[model samples]
Target: MPHPILETTDLTVRFGGHVAVDHITCNFNAGELTAIVGPNGAGKTTYFNLISGQIPVSEGRVKLNGTDITRMSVAQRTHRGIGRAFQLTNLFPNLSVLENIRLVVQSKAGRGFNILSMADSHAELTGPAYEILERIRMTDQADQVVSELSHGDQRKLEVALLIALDPLVYMFDEPTAGMSVDEAPVVLDLIAELKTRKDRAILLVEHKMDVIRTLADRIIVLHNGALAADGDPAEVMASDVVQEAYMGRDLEEALANV
Candidate 1:
């Protein structure tokens, strides 16, 4: 097996007297899409936060390609090729789509000092910014202010922002949380496309089993801050432990309909 692009060893997180994430260890291999699923308060997002350096770990360590990054700050992790999209859409609402992406491109290029300059003057940044727009199918909306776009479009732009960072591992926390059923597929397709790249690793925290079933190469189920099940999607979903603890009878009915 290929060495994991990202890994955690006995990772733990505590909130005063409460434990948000128990001692858990797992590896995310390059080119794989691993779905982290569980009921509410399952520690799925907490795990993402720990690995992405959004929060400090109380125990264990996070490693990227064998390099220990447990002590790295959020920006430091981003600089080291870790990118994440939160459950809520993160975008510059007042900026045009292209402009929003351009800023990220500029920041990544270490040209934050020139952010006040005309965006058109920087072909190096604008060029790639346009390219990302094309990839996200947002080129036509490039000049539209983010606030003017639909909720789904804003979600797409958020993913585009992450793409602009060019991270080795992409962590998506409920990327389709508030999207309409029709809009959900648009973001899902983008994620599916990202999974096709052989050098990138994708870690997702999602509650939609249909989405998880369609895209996950592997599924990790968390319950009460501990791992409940981890394996192929079908097997994990079929497991009595998961069905009893998380999915219950509804999952079986859902799967039966399929």
Candidate 2:
């Protein structure tokens, strides 16, 4: 088998006295979308934090394409081809949508922001930014301030920013959390479009079963911060632990704690 693009070997993290993610060892390959699912506080997001360098690892190591990166900072990890979009909207509320994406493209191109001379000298930057916006179908809103966009549009823009980076691994935490039913599909479609790339590995943490069923090529379940099941989506979703720990009374109790 091909080496996994992203690998977590006995990956673990703790919050002071609490062990949030308990020794998870897994590998994610290119050309696959793996959905991470668990009840609240099951360490799904915490595990993401470990892989993306958002938090320190209490133990174990995170590797990208076989190179250990447990000590890398968040920016370093992004530079190494890991892009994550969070559950909340993370944007420059004051900047126009085009500017937001252009900044990323420019940064990726190694032309650090030129705040003093902002006279469109970088056609190379805007050209790709416009293409990203067009890919997400946000062409009409390119000039709008990010603060003025609806939650759904902002979510789409976040995905566009991730695309602008063109990371080898794409991580999303509930990409459609706040959108109206009608608006969620647009983001899902964008994700589905990314899934077609043979060089990309996608990791998603979502509670929505419909979204999981729709996009996940594989499913890995986390329970009490450990791997409960990992396999085909249909089989994993139907497994005993997922049925009991995630959907049964245990899940209700877990949700209450969260």
Global lDDT scores for all candidate models:
0.87, 0.87
For candidate 1, lDDT tens digit of each residue in 90-113?
789999999999988988998887
* C-alpha positional error of residue 70 in candidate 2 after TM-score superposition, expressed in Å: 0.6
Residues 92-201, model 2: lDDT tens digits: 99999999999889878877856686637778899999998888888999999999998889988887888899899999998888788887887898889889987899
Per-candidate clash tally: 0, 0
**TM-score for all models, in order of appearance:** 0.91, 0.92
Off by over 4 Å in 2: 113-119, 247-258
After best superposition, candidate 1 residue 18: deviation in angstroms? 0.6
